[model samples]
Target: MTYRADPARYDSMQYRHSGRSGLKLPVISLGLWQNFGGTRDYPGAMEILGHAFDAGITHFDLANNYGPPAGSSEELFGQVMARDFRPYRDELIISTKAGYNMWPGPYGEFGSRKYLIASLDQSLKRMGLDYVDIFYSHRYDPNTPLEETVGALAQVVRQGKALYVGISSYPEAETREAHRILKQMGVATTIHQPSYSVLNRWIENDHTIDACGELGIGIIAFSPLAQGVLSGKYNSGAKEGTRAASSNTTLRASHVEPRVLEAVDKLGAIARARGQSMVQLALSWALRRKEMTSALVGVRTLDQLKDNLGVLNNLELSADEIAQIDEATKDGQMELHPSPKGWLR
Candidate 1:
């Protein structure tokens, strides 16, 4: 089928600037972290991509390490780029990251200049792209000199391989330092990716959110649904194939304990009263911050994706609603590994 985008694609979608940069990303971005990998159905992935774009989602986020076999997600997305998106390349904001282990040995991961440079080349090759709109250091490397890591990002921009650079899961001090280092190199730390949701509030407690806003670094929140905890799907219990039931998933069965389900019930009640689903309520809460550029969503089914996009129906959160959410989730904690050196999983 010839993929012609919806003629009215841009009519209802909203865009927000990444920090103070001129680049505007859709309020909701599709992420290729899970279901777009090689193990999934290729045609189904294409259908999701096609529909996402038709709904005015202009940003697609990926990482070099985003698959069961590692790099498979990028390879799958490369096919989509070659087939359906070549004509609309300039209309998209494609971003990829390095800094996780992609291969073996010393230079396989981290913030080394060698690893970043080599990784970007390999990523570009795998994705069939000359450059990514935004390149990110997926995590902070405590051992590597921050300057060395950020300097490689600057080099890629000058070399025309990446237009903008960002950092993810970096603490407040490191984020401030990365911005300063990039500024010295005549580059802006355009964005930050972090795990943020109504249940997980590390960014808020650790002051990472405040730091990005103060530094003019836009935040694109991942895991806004808290690994399905906020989706109200687990109020009864973890189903047979749910993420919490999977041994390899980051969301453990233990994380969805009785206390957590209780919080979900309270949150769901608040959402239903306002005529919004639990997922949309979670999204609305995450995007309530002005510094949030987009909320990155990973969906396995087209129906799930549509449910997430239903957030467009009600985007605003009143002060009272915000207060209610806070009170309900005050004691809620999803056992996550968040720190200055790493982010929540």
Candidate 2:
């Protein structure tokens, strides 16, 4: 059966301005990073996405190389958009990225003008859209000159292929440089996508958050759930079939160590005091930041989306609760900066 999102769903969502830009993004955005990819479940993805829109999620994030088969997520999402979201196209904020490996050849990746332009064209084709609301350079290409990359992004804006450009996973230094160059080119470098969650504090300590606020760049934090680590779904001695059960090179089976799980347990206790789930506590914490325009997360099922949306109903975090969480993870259970590996898909 086809799903039709309720028009009244938008009433509960809070939209915040994207930096100094006129655009306002939903407080919670959906990201097609893992489950939407080929390795995960399809029906689960559809249910999650459908429920999210019905619960007032206006922004959906994607990338060229998101799926195991590369571009498969966008292709799948294109099908969903055609079947369900076609009527509400103007009400959505869709974004896709390039700069990571897409195809097999050298021209298939990187931030070169040739690669950027061609990749965007291919992404638009896969998504079945003429233009993406926001396009991102997935990562910094040290091999490509910053000027060349920024110029290509500006060109895309001028050509109307994308309304805005954003940078992801760039170091603080490179991010500042890119911001300068993009502004000089007359393109509003509206947003910066970085990883931030209770487990990942690199943005806070590394000045990425402060710099973006000072420069008027809105921040949309990706992986704010820490790849599902902050949801109280996994424990140190958890049995198989959990998120930490799979042992991959990027996120080792042991990454969910005893210390990490211990922190999660303690945090769960704090959440109980507030009458919320651990995931809701984590999402609400991310949104409390000044530079944070939105929290980008992935959902594997409709139940997860509904649970996550409940966080917005209670955004109040007291000073004592904040200090308690700070002490619980004093050693930092998960390190997000200079990420030891990529666990996105």
Candidate 3:
């Protein structure tokens, strides 16, 4: 069957301007962090992608080291682009990142001119993209000189390999410095991708959110559901095939602490009162900030994808509801995906 995008795609989903820039991303963007990697997963990933675009989700986020085998997700995305999504390229906001351990040896990872430039090249090849909509340093490289790292990012824009550049999971001070350095180089540091959710408010505690707000950098929160801990999925126990039960996943079963589960149980009650599922509550809470441009979600199935999009139905939270949520979660039971004062995934 030919893939024709929904003519009403732009009708339902909401878009917020990314920082002060002219670019606006859908309030909910799809991320290919997992389950979009395997050769056998292609058909399923394709269907999810189609449904997402049909729902007005224009942005798709990825990283160089996203796949289980590393680099496979981009290959999968490229296959979809070639087969079904090629005609709709102009309607999509495709972004990828580097700066994690991709291959072995010194040049395979980190934020260096050598590694970043080479990684983006490989990513462009793998995704069959002439240029990505956004390219980010996947994590802050304390070992690398910030100048060299930011310089490579600026260079890519000048060379026309990336349309815009961003940073992910960076601490507050480094984020400010990166913005300054990019500004000096005549590039706008467009967005900041951080791990922010009800359970993990590292961005708020560390002042990263304030810094980005003051600097006019848009925020797109990843792990907004604490990798599904807040989804009421693991409140009972580690279900089969959940991220918590899987040893390969970043969110280990051990990470879903007992106290956090208790806190989430209370939240589930509140969600029911508000006529929302736990997933919708978490996502809506993340987007409550005016500075937030989008909330990035990774879905394994068409059902999960549609369920996530349901957050848009009533993103509004009453003041009393906010206070109730704050009190319920303020016990610091937020250890499920607890990020330390300075850094986290």
Local distance difference test values of all predictions, in order: 0.88, 0.83, 0.87
Q: Give the local distance difference test score of model 3.
A: 0.87
Candidate 2, poorest ten consecutive residues by summed lDDT: 336-345
- Poorest stretch of ten by lDDT in candidate 3: 336-345
**What is every candidate's alpha-carbon RMSD to the true fold?**
1.5, 2.1, 2.0
C-alpha TM-scores of all predictions? 0.96, 0.93, 0.96
lDDT of candidate 2 at residue 241, scale 0 to 100: 55
State the TM-score for model 1: 0.96
Ranking by lDDT: 1, 3, 2
lDDT tens readout by residue for model 3, 78-109: 98999899999999999999987788898988
**How should the candidates be ordered by TM-score, best one leading?**
1, 3, 2
Q: Which candidate, 1 or 3, has the higher TM-score?
A: 1
Off by over 4 Å in 3: 332-345
- Candidate 2 overall Cα lDDT vs. reference? 0.83
